[model samples]
Target: MITVLVIGIGTGSPDQLTTEAVAALNRTNLFLVPDKGADKHDLATLRRELCETLIDHDRYRFVEVPDPDRGPDAERATDAYRAAVAEWHAERARRYAATIRDQLGSDGTVGFLVLGDPALYDSTIRIAESIRDDGRLDLAIEVIPGISSLSLLAARHKITLNRIGQPVHVTTGRRLPEEYRPELGDVAVMLDGSLQCKQLLPKHGDLTIYWGAQLGLPDEVLISGRLGDVIDEIEAARNAARAQRGWVLDIYLLRP
Candidate 1:
């Protein structure tokens, strides 16, 4: 049987890795690093650097598996989007199964270093479950949680996620409108490629946003103010980040 550990290494900092995550890193016989190509080569390069710095021994090896594209239509949240995501996940599962079968010993451990906690807006967990349920390999899966961008976003802003006894609501950029009621407390928005907050400013005049991009990385940027006041600033920052780094991963807390 092969045991796979889905370890979260946090957004972009080595310090974000938990002690257990680091220990799991050293235990794996093989590591699967996904290559999304040159535009995101910085991502793959960072993973390789992480192994070089953290792994105490050279007994292990890492392979760069070319990641399958979920494509353009999958970017939206809709029935077609769901279908595209399902197909993309299926492709990923096939690649993962082939990698494990070809490279791992029956009893060896494989590690997947996720960017954030697997339970939050990440697909590695589902893909691993798919492989296990297929019954083609004797596999066991484990998860070691790491600091999520949401957590770090809160930390960087130095604000609690909730107001008083109210709870924090989490939703994606596309679903922001559905979850827009401020009475529900603070809403943490993620996976927003478009500046969806602009739409809320007209009606929700009191909306405030605490936003950050590339949280733990050197390119980190933070903004906080009334939505109407800072939306343009956030957009400018996001655009500048994408222009310079060719990519930007951002999250924000909306207080309504």
Candidate 2:
């Protein structure tokens, strides 16, 4: 049996690693790093940097795991998009299973570092569980949680995720229109590049938005104001930032 530690490393920064997370990194002798193509090369670099900075021993080795493409993040309908994502996860499971069998021994311990908490928007845990369910390898999985981008978003902006006693809603950009209304209190939107935010401005102009991109990195950007007042500015900044950096991971809070 192998132990798979799905560690949450937080947004692209070494300081975000919890004491437990750091310990987990050092405990594992092999690290599986995800390669998200040229556009996301920086992401892989960040992961490498974390291992280099935290792990004191030279005994650990890393293997690059290529990401299976799930196609463009286009504006697809819910069912179509979900089906596409399911297929993508299946392919990833196949690759992961192959890697585990080829690289890890029955007694081996390997680690997969995910950005933010594994329970958040990340799919690493799901992939690992799927691999285990396949019966190709006996995998004992452990999840180490870290500061999520959502948590940092609120921290950077100095606001709580929810309004006084009001509920906080978690949603994706695609479902924002259907799931959120100005009366919903505080809504945290992820997997949205502030692109889907445009659709909401037409009806909820008075709503305020607290947005941040590259939350923990040096290129971090924050914009907050009335939805109608700053929507254009945010859109332009997001596009320009993504163009310059080749990638951006952002989260935002929409408040009524």
Which consecutive 10 residues in model 2 have the weakest lDDT in total? 193-202
**Strongest candidate by lDDT:** 1
TM-score of each: 0.96, 0.96
CA lDDT for candidate 2: 0.86
Error of 1 at 202 (Å): 1.5
| C-alpha positional error of residue 47 in candidate 1 after TM-score superposition, expressed in Å | 1.1
| Tens-digit lDDT string for candidate 1 (158-242) | 9989888889989988888766886778899999889787888779857889999999999999999998888888999999999
User: Which regions of candidate 1 deviate over 4 angstroms?
Assistant: 74-77
lDDT of 2 at 245: 78
